[model samples]
Target: MDEQLNHAPCGFLTLSEDGFILEMNQTLLKILNYSHDSLIGQHVNSILTVPARLFSQFYFFPLVKLEQRVEEMYISLEAGNGEEIPVLINALLRKVNERTVLECIIIPMRKRNEFENELLLAKKETEAALKAKHKAITELETTLKKLEIQKQELLELNQQNQKYKIETQKELELARIIQETSLTDPINNDKVQMEVFYNASGELSGDIYGIYQIDQNRYGIILLDVMGHGISSALITMTLHSLFQRLISAGVPVDLVMKELDSHLHKLFDNNEEARHYSTAIYLLIDTERQKIDYANAGHPPALWQDPNGTQYELSSTAPPLGTFEGVVFKTNTFTYKKGGRLLLYTDGVDPLISNYLAPLVRKTVSLPLFQLKQEILQCLNNEKKVDFKSDDETFILVDLK
Candidate 1:
């Protein structure tokens, strides 16, 4: 598939009759500025602007179905980076492996040609309208001058917006880099092994995790999901990242850590209601020497724990999320650890129905080899069906205890 279609000059996409994308060429993914996983299982409407989607639904699909093909149908696609691209698409219905699919070849229109064509069409339409109305020459000249001035102003405004967009993108990229750096490297040693996966819906994420060695035999792990998305949430995560490092490095108790976090968030947002945001977090302190785990869950999803004997336990929420109220106290819960026991900690983005989605997977795969378990978890998360519903940042930490 890559050798034949990936390098084609024009973008290509194959979709189910219902408009779900089944296959896409590299060219289309590049043109849309989207990753394969992001678009592969999504609907055709995912890439179309609202009007373009309506056009496809009302006219494009019906015409293609009647004639078995469509050619030079102009539409605008919304790129992953939020740019709208004007395109001319040719589509045909075909059978592949006994299943019917809609195959499309999309050619992006050159900006100059698009603008010139629109201008010419508009001019012709206006001239005819003016002649029918028998308008005076002076009136027509005044209207043309006004339209030209407005067009020039619009062009200048678009240039300024484009420049600002580029600058904002660069800044967000830098902030993303900084946030990624704050994540602790995965730990693999004789005592315990850890693996992590993180996926953000956008350039900046509201989820953050860290693993810290508090002492020779004690390790502290934390995962937090801030409310909402974008710059505000990302900024809060960064601020909490620093505080989490300070508290965990000093070996703050799990319950105290949760309390301090809640307090900090309240203090941080006390004045501004609009800017106020909260976080759901879980803090775990693993004592390898004692073979025990102490954790405090602040309204986050339960952490899945499976013993060596295949028994699973859920460390459920023990307190409200941070900043939900003033001076909230947190309670610590303990779970006995055993050899070959595995623990899974994840943010809610794993699934909106968090309990139903994760519990069965953990029970079935917890006893498998670590590598296989990791693969299963990741494959489930990356499934096109699952990706279609995901709207928040997804993160998980899998711990293997020896």
Candidate 2:
């Protein structure tokens, strides 16, 4: 038994009841960093670093003495190098040959300490990485919110722009309706018979014409073509209608009306340096009792006269367009129509559409009844393959004297 205890792989020691080391193996001497001679007479608690008074005051010695054994108590041992070494200790109290003694075993814990330190370092690194990822997520959320706000603002702006466009279109349509009503009303009690047909390419037109009765036996007719198309041209036509109505209602002469209208327009548009604005017109006064028609053309197409015996002829222009020159004398042509005669006045848009296939039909002048003439013109236009419905404003007026 002594040989087996001496050659054991682990450290073992025996302590007397007075806490003095009684016996120790060579392994205990080496593990404690002491020689057997140094440890044998010393107190066991003196080598352990823990005070012997702690075991006595805590009743651990009494429990061991009464229970005869205690298992797995952890303690620290001080090496010769002054480093703390962890150890697992077991103690057993027994009586051998009438002497009570305590037996203890010591085990080292170096590898367990190394594993715990590595675990602490790994936890710190994982926490730092998680903090960085959280910060990036917060920044991305803020940027996404700002972009959403800008998208909403752009959507609101588009809605407002669409609303303004709809309102402007409605106002323009209303103005067009008013202009049509003013131009198409025929004044009764006239010496001349007058009828008008007008078609516009869009909601508004540039072509304008009307008949004004001066008295029971005398009447005046005007066909005006404002330059350009669409809203710009329609505005010019409206301006002319206003000025002419005011002057003729004030009993102005037919020739003087054109002179005053030109002067007024020149003054109103003098500040417009582009000078691209002007209107071409024809003004005619017919005296049914005397069978004479007095007419002045201002850069407009000649009027066609059809006699009772089926003779067709054109009355040519004698002056430049109105608003082109100030104080220009307009020549008035006098032509005597038979009691049963017909006259036709039209804008340029009318013949140009038919001229595609009816170039020959239009060039040959044929005098026919009013209804027959209108039918022939329509027939010529219908024969064309590519008829452009999106033509410019067209107007034609036919007057028959019975």
Candidate 3:
């Protein structure tokens, strides 16, 4: 019986009430040009055209439930290669193993002359009705024309929007590349060594830092965090990068540089109320010859300093954040740092991750190497359960003064 059913004259398919294909005969697979494994357990709509799926959802299921059968239902089935095949179907709703199923026998309509004749009869009836309502027919035609024009306009607008999006994505990617390249490279020397780890939340970063050599024994280090991140802040950071290089290389005092930067920001955003922005920064001039670091902090996070004896110190902020007020005189503080000590600088993004464990981390890991210290900080952040560390751009700089 199974062999005869598989090679039957018509295609046979069994589907669940929810339109999933439960079983199908070899004849159905051959007719749809699909492999047995591909169609088994597939949804019935996967093999149905758009209109056929709509018809199955509304008329086919309702009629089967009302009468327990569907007879001579004409529908189009989509084949494996996307070809539409018109078929006449007869289905029976029955219970097998206490589960209701739809068993459909489909006959391929290769010569659709009968179907075309039926459509012609329906068209003739519609034409007779239009003759009695000529004004309504004319209004419907005009409305259809307007709808077609609107659809065409929407398609054009969508195409333009897609093109613009592609161009904008390309531009942003290029900007990100340029910003990355503009960042400072690692500084290593006999007197000091520095390493930086930075992660941007988006395509661009608002944090910028650099180490510049001022003299044979003096090196200037600056880390700045703009108001927020992304395009606008990144642009300001790039501008600051150039300005900072020039100022530090010229051996400007830390206090004077902070004052100049504050004035510059005010001048840039003075007229624009919407673009009121400020920044926090810490500038350090490390003198290996004098064994001291002259630093200035502008409402930024404190720098963590650890001596060789496992003693930790916090270099707190000395002034308000930049762009806050004009004519501000920044103060520079000096700290004596011994050889074999380490300093940690970071943006506020790192605060939430290590706020509770920073002192212990610095004290315990002070004897470890700089790279190991970085690993320790990372492990601590990973073990933290209270905060999402990556919610903002996280950047940290580790300096080993040797």
Candidate 4:
């Protein structure tokens, strides 16, 4: 315990009322840079620095005498080398034989002083940083205004895009209506009656068909399905209609007409090799004179035939699709006359095997009008359990022999 007291972190001392030091610990001796003999009888006023002596005489000693204790008074002392040493001093006054004696502890304050200096420096740095940040915020307000303008511009552009999209949709709907209404008149010739049905997947039909009166007793009927669906395919159908008229009006044979159509399309789309665009078709000529249907199939679906007694025949494909190559050969097939019979030609889209939701449409001997039959097909599709938008373009050209 004695060793601990002597080596305590703070200096300990005893002094008389006359300011004469009576005893001191090893820590106190070390703090003052003194031996025990040098400080034993020395005056306290002589050990303190001049300013410290003045502070102690005027305030520190007077306060300790009146209050019995003075706590944490910072003072300076003169070391043996005459250098100032800062200390936090605590003093207590005790009466022994009616004479006041002072007990004191002096703790070194140099590290705490350094800490205060560093704290002040940090406070200054924080203030400087806050000032710079305030300046940056003041400057950024202008940029924020500019960003708000750009945001408004973007919102306006989006509105314009929505308007344009609505307008384009209306135009597309009109074009589809035009394509729908472009069908030829019903062929109620002396020997046959025809009914046609068309339904597009979207606002346009990529599949197209037509019937033309070639002579007094012969009628031309063609079903064309462009290789794709949408605007590009629909555009091809229009060109197809124009080309078909130019050829058939000039009396081109069914096979040569197909060949010529392929050659014409290849010249437009194909380079040295095949072009990406092409169509599949089945073209036939109804002859009341010979009681025959002279027909050629080009990668098109088979025509469904129903006799008066409800017998079914599928006339399948005979050649590849058109616009693929020049002078491509197409085979012809002929079907004999059947009274009160019907022939159904269509794209693969209407094939019942492809879509389960589509009901198998058997051609009836009790035929409806052409438009009424179209409504029937439409009703059949709409009454499905689910609407499949991905459903392909379906076009059926139904011919009935009277």
Best by lDDT: 1
TM-score ranking from best candidate downward: 1, 3, 4, 2
Q: Comparing 1 and 4 by lDDT, which wins?
A: 1
Task: Report the C-alpha lDDT of model 3 over 1-402, residue by residue, as the tens digit.
Answer: 289998999999998988899889988888899998898888998898755664575457766898999876668898999788988788999999999999999988664454445445555555565576655776656555655555565566567557656755765676678777877876888988887888777888988888888888998988989988876777777767887888998999989888888887887676555666788999999999999999999988998888878788888898999898777779999989789998988887766433577767778776687788888877765665255544666688899999
| lDDT agreement of model 4 with the native | 0.73
Mind giving the per-residue lDDT tens digits that candidate 2 earns over 182-265? 885654333455556787768888888877766666667788887766765676677688788776655566678788767766
The window of 10 residues in a row where model 3 has the poorest summed lDDT is 111-120
The segments of candidate 3 whose C-alpha lies over 4 angstroms from its true place after superposition are: 1-137, 382-390
TM-score on alpha carbons, each prediction: 0.65, 0.57, 0.64, 0.59
lDDT for 391 (candidate 1): 74
**Which sections of candidate 1 miss by over 4 Å?**
1-136, 384-387
Query: Candidate 2 lDDT (Cα, whole model)?
Result: 0.68
Better of 2 and 3 by lDDT: 3
How much is 357 displaced in model 2, in angstroms? 9.1
Clashes of 1: 0
lDDT of 1 by residue, 123-154 (tens): 77567758766777777777677557656755
**Model 4, residue pairs in steric clash:** none
Off by over 4 Å in 2: 1-151, 187-192, 249-251, 352-372, 375-385, 388-390
Error of 4 at 130 (Å): 15
Superior by lDDT: candidate 2 or candidate 4: 4
State each model's CA lDDT, in order: 0.82, 0.68, 0.80, 0.73
